[model samples]
Target: MLPPSVVKDRVGRTLDRMTSQNIDALILFSREDIRYLAAFDQACICLVIPKEGNPTALGLWLDIDEARRQSWVQDTRGFVPQYHLRIGGGEAQRRRLVEVLIEKGLSRGRIGIERGLLTLEMFDTLKSGLPEAVFVDATPVLKGLRIVKSKEEVELIRRASEIADCAMEAVSQITDVGRKESDLAAEAEYVIRRSGGEVLSKTLVGSGKRTLCAHPFPTEKTLEREDLVYIDIHPSYKGYHSDLCRTFLLGRDATKEKAHETLVAAQRATFEATAPGIDPEQIYKAGISSIESSIYGRNFLELYGHGTGLNVEEPPMITKGCREKIDENMTISFFQGALTMPGSYGLRIEDTGVVTKKGVKLFTRYPTDLLR
Candidate 1:
């Protein structure tokens, strides 16, 4: 749970955005947005935040108590499904949400919504329910506000990165020949949970031939003496996420060692280029130039990195043609992965941190040297 002041600050910023856009109220259905504003995480929940006033959260009866305890909002209403009525479950929920908006005096005003998160059926329902209200897509507005992190949010991400470092250390200690990839992944997860962290995504563990595929799930494949192992971990602390990736060589090979060196150098260039007021394109170009300068010049991915926060992947994507500039207090993950050839092997290095005035403050501090 976040501090009440932090929650209030986020809500204030969101409300200001709403006011700027002339939105009488903003209805958040996406779990990430709701959690960011109200700190309420539950299914069948919706948060209605007006331009100027306290927000209201509508949740199921079973979860309303917990929502009240966790959420900063004082007005939490539990929805009682009217099963005996002719209305269906979806209709009932939609009607309840519409009623809330009407009571807030937004029935005939412009209301902001996450169009990307809503299904066509639900969107139609919303439109039909409030015929006089103008619903506009506010995804960009919400994402724009969330791109920057507060001090408390950055602290949580740092703690999450620390847990990721610990988990990687556990992996280093257990990675060896004859060990199953599943076993190593299990060990890492245990370390994260015991260290007061939660796994945000599937722990990526690939070895040998599996390393060729990006985003491969852990399998029963056993480690070999001469194999390339890749691990990507996403750990969260207090709803803030951090991403870390590292590739290790089971046995020494000059070619793989040189690739590792090149990868580290590219990541270093990215870190050096990251700072406030710098175009993200420049940071990406710096990384690409450094990678192409090495012997594994032809091995590069299209995407270098992305912004990180409540969601594992967020806005300000670090890719070609993206014009998003890095700003102060924004947290980003700088990563680069390459495969020398198809079905051969791969190497990657990723680090997460907060952007400072001059540079980035790295959080994941695990050694990038290829583990023997």
Candidate 2:
């Protein structure tokens, strides 16, 4: 279903914050955020900005049907009434937005935008087009609101996790010797979406040293007795996604078995360390406790985990140097990396966890043990 209430509350909160931040308007570009506001089903370029009377969205003629739906939008209209087709001329979109901003009195006020997603070319275009506008960094403000999940959002994510768990279960049952990594990945995807999962990303089923490479795509790598097979799935259900990683023993890998035991311990430590108000560094330490300190000292290139919500990645990072406190209702991913020599296997066991007032709750329920 459409997230009308979430958008409504979000819009209300955003307008309140805009008043305090002195932001007159925000022009959004990403589809996810646009979907959140417009509640549209189709994907097309659209613009949304706050104004004196109501928020406005502008789209090409192709998205007229979707824009008219107004799932979360209070008001919307097509860019040109006469034009019955989509146009992508850089100059045309720029001029229309400038005119809208000027009419809304936002030409000289603070205009919010996403700096990372918006290109430098587009930034220059907006700047050159609207010389009087004072652009403000709205990323932080919007991120703050999105980091915490509402009850409804959490429910949707839980539903996604359930579907992912079913996919993993099916994959485990059908997987055996003589099967290729790609075959297993296909089975997982097939079972997952058929059982109501929306496949948001491609699956990863790497074997042996291939597992050492994070996000290794499905390949024809044959199974080996002493090979460590790792499968990771990032799935979306009801528009909420779950990113999970699990390991498997192709035949009888002694190194993989030992690594699995160590990783299980490390994951347990990480889970135990996670709770509302706890420092995220403490969680990272737990993830690395089972391994040697030198490994983390020299090879810690990525974050321990990150918050997950509407998108695969969310704000309020769970990593070192980040002080974003874990609050109740915040949903986050708990991931542990596997980087070492010898067998060259990376063991990452991740789950969607929610922060509660007293403790943390994991949405994923699959067993962590790898077959020997």
Candidate 3:
């Protein structure tokens, strides 16, 4: 959990943005956004942040007490019947939210909402309840505010990276010929969970032909000699996410080793080229140029990296034509590699890091060597 001062600063910054947009109030529904501002870990129905007063978090009756205990928000409420015992939990919560908005004098005022995340039911309720209010999308505003990491956020991400590194090391030790791809995934997951971390996304273990497939999950297929296997681990500590991937060659093969070397070179080039004020597109170009010089250049993947923190993939995605500036304090998951052949084999390497005045400070410190 972040300090109360950090949460206050975040809410203050959000309120500033809201005032600039002339929004009378802001409604947050997504768990990510809600947790960002409130530190409420459980699923919630609504979190209303007015322009002048404290924010209100509305959740299910069962989780309301936990919400109060966990979040910095003081005005947490649970579902209660408006008049009789007829309304359901969802409707009751929406009704209470509308009342709160009305009480705060925002019933017919300009409101900001996460249009991309809100469900159709919540949208309809808000529109009908506050017929004269204008709903502006707050997706960009919210995303923009979280692009740069605070010192606390960076530390959580760093710890998560260490967890990923441990998982990768465990996977490397057990990866051998005849082992099931699922076994590697199991070991990685066990290490992460035992380390007080969570696997919130796919535990990818792609081997042989499966390496060509994007975001492939582990299966029961057994590993064989001279096959390429890639393990992508996603782990989170205290709501912060980190991604790390390493490719392994089951048996020594010169062609596969060279392919892995090209990936490492590309990753290194991308890292060396990264700095504050750099264009994300330039980073992509540098990585692609490194790959183009290799034998497997034709099979290069388009993406070079992405911003990572609360989520696995975030803004300022490093790709061709991306215009977002690479700023200091931004956490990035620098990744590059490509398929050696269409249906034969592929290799990839990834690590998490933070952008500093000097360059990207890598968080995941596991070696990128192709484990045998």
Candidate 4:
């Protein structure tokens, strides 16, 4: 859980952005945005944040008690859902949300909504309920506020990265010949859970030829000698996520060993290119230049990386054509890899870090060397 002051600061920044954009109130639909504002972590809950008043949270009757206890908002309301409605199950709930908005004197004012997350049916219902109110897309405003991380948020991300490191260490110690990839993945997840961290994404474990694919899931395939194995772990603490990936080898192979070395160099170049006042596109170019200087350059993939914080992928993307400048206290995940050829083994190295005045401060500290 975050401190009261930290939560207040987050809400204050959001309110400031809303004022600048002339938005009277914001109706949040995504769980991430709601949790970030009110510290509530439940589903089917709607949050209404006014520009100058205390925020309100609307939830089901069964979850109102928990919402009141967990969320920082003072005005929490409950509504009973009528499942008998065949067209839409939550008509009653939606009507309650609109009623609350109107009661708050926002019926004729401009309302901000998450267009990407809202369903077409819900949008229609809201439009019909508040015909005078103008609905404006607030996705950019929300993303702008969330792009920079505060001191407390950075600490949570650091702790999440530490948990990922522990899980990867467990993977390195328990992996052996003839062991199933699924078994290793399960062990890694257990390690994260035991350390009081939640698994944000599936624990990806790929070995041998399966490593060619970027996002392969663990399978029943048995490990063999000289096979290359890689694992990607995403774990979270207090809603802050960390992305980490590392590669290993069952036995020694010169070609794969060289590729691992090149990938590490590319990752280092990316880290060196990251700092305050630098464009993210420059960082991506630096990484590509470093990779192309190696023998495995032609095998490099196009996808680079992106920002990581409340969500696994966020703003200030580290890719081509992104003109966003990297600012201090921004957290980003850097990934660079290469496949020798189609259907052939590959190697990748990724880590999460925070941008600083000088350079990036890495959170994931697991060794990147290919395991023998």
Candidate 5:
């Protein structure tokens, strides 16, 4: 949990943005977006931040207590029975939101909603309730606010990275010939949970032919000698996510060993080009160039990496076409350190880091060496 002051500053900044955009009120629907603003982690909850007054959180009656306890907003409300016992689905919540808007004298004003995340049913309900109010998409406004991390957010990501490192170490110790891919996944998840991290997704443990698949889930396939194995762990601490991957070989292979070295060299090149004011494509091209120079040149994945934060993947994607500049405090991932050869094997090395004045500071420190 972040300090109350940190949350307050975040809301204040949001309100400033709202004022400039002439948005009367902003309603956040997605759990990740709500968590970003209110620190309340309920998918059924909605946070309404008016341009003038304090923000309000609305949730189910059963969740109101926890919502109030966890969220920074004081005017947290819940949908309970007024007469007949009925907590109608999406419509009821939108009706409650409409009433709140009317009460706050914003019925005829411009309201900002997450068009990308909001349901059509809820949008219609609000439209029916307040026919005069104009609704605008607030997705860009919110994305602009969340692309950069606060100091506290960076610390939380660091802690999550540490937990991922521990999980990788645990997986490495237990990975051996005859062990099932699921077995290694279990070991990684156990370490993640015991280290105060939340398992955001199933740990990916791909070996042999399965390594060629993108984001493959762990299976019962048993490891064999000389098999190429990779473990990608997704863990979260205080809603900040860390994505890390490390590849290894069950036995020595000169070609694969050199391939791993090439991947590491590509990662170094990528890092060298990452800094404030540099284009993301420049960083991407550096890795692509390093990999293309190697014998395994044709295995380049089209993507370089992306921004990560409240959600595993977020804005300011590190692709060739993205127009956003690399700014200080932006949390990013170097995920392009992967090479794939269909029907044969694949290898990857990834790390999460933040851009600072000095350079790109990586959080996950698990060695990139091809573990034997």
Candidate 6:
């Protein structure tokens, strides 16, 4: 659940985006955007037509319960309910959506829709149903609105980080030298659900060298005495997702002291380069340079970190060749890892961080070391 203030902020920003772009009405269907503007959590394709006077949201009749519970609209009781076709093609909702627009004096006004995520088929359906209204693409408008984070949204992200931190702490305790990758991952989810964390990204614990594969699913591979462990965990708390990763070693001699020193140096360099107004490319290079000059080879995981928010992955990536300016309240991750570790072991460490006026705020507070 999200704070009502956050939902309102999102809706207000989206309305401003639509209004400034000269959009007559907004027909929101994207799941993320829908949740952004209104807290609609049902798994149905909903259409939201916002007019100058009144705004109407349309969804499947079956989702009325969920829509009512989630929507933060002040007058959702006044919203028109329409039933969607089970076949996902033609729906009674489409006709009613158009009819509601016509009633709201939008017969000749432009209807805005998120174009990037919507399909051509849906566009055809909307156009066919509302032949009188002009359809205008609103992808850029919505993105521009969402790019800046409000204080409420920022608080959600911070709360999400605390929940993710609890989950990782559980994993740190349960993941021993002999635990299987699958067991470690399953236990991660166990703690998350138990701690009231919403599991958005699938939990994965890659043991030993297998951790090098970035998005590897859970495996039955058993942990080794000298293996490296990387846990990729993303959990949603208060409707905001947290993306965090931690890599550690197992047994008494999991990683050599020299290797640990090199990685610590790299991580420090990356952290030093992180700030509110630093160039992302150069900051990423600061960390990668330590790896290349170390005993390890040139490449070690592709980039440093990506932005984390509603989605685990987002733009404003902290990677080389990215020319975007870093701003305050922009949360990011720093994955200072060594996929190119000598002796064929994956040693990667990641943490969620936020850009502040002075430096980055580290969210995940767990310690990084080889499991013994």
| Clashes within 3 Å, all models in order | 0, 0, 0, 0, 0, 2
lDDT of 6 by residue, 230-262 (tens): 888888775677777777776556235456666
Q: Clashing pairs in model 1?
A: none
Please give the TM-score that candidate 6 achieves against the real structure: 0.84
User: Can you give the TM-score per candidate against the true fold?
Assistant: 0.93, 0.88, 0.93, 0.94, 0.93, 0.84
Score candidate 5 by TM-score against the native.
0.93
Residues 76-128, model 1: lDDT tens digits? 98866541111124677777777888888887989888877767766787788
Q: Give lDDT: candidate 5, residue 51.
A: 87
Greater TM-score among 2 and 4 belongs to: 4
Cα lDDT tens digits for candidate 2, 11-110 = 7787787777777788777666665555664544555567455666666666766667655564555656443212333666656766667777776878
Off by over 4 Å in 3: 80-93
- Could you tell me how far off, in angstroms, the CA of residue 257 lies in candidate 1 after the best superposition? 1.5
What is the C-alpha lDDT profile of model 5 across 49-152, one tens digit per residue?
88887778777778788878887788988767431112235455567777888888888989998887767777888888889999998865686788888888
lDDT tens string, model 3, 155-239? 9999999999999999999899999999999999999999999888879998889998787789999999888898999899988
List runs of model 6 lying over 4 Å from the truth: 1-9, 45-51, 74-82, 85-108, 131-136, 252-261, 336-338, 341-343
Q: After superposition, how far is residue 136 of candidate 3 from its true place, in Å?
A: 1.0
Error of 3 at 193 (Å): 1.5
What CA RMSD would you report for each candidate?
A: 2.7, 3.2, 2.8, 2.3, 2.6, 3.5
Full-model lDDT for every candidate: 0.83, 0.71, 0.84, 0.84, 0.83, 0.70
Clashing pairs in 3: none
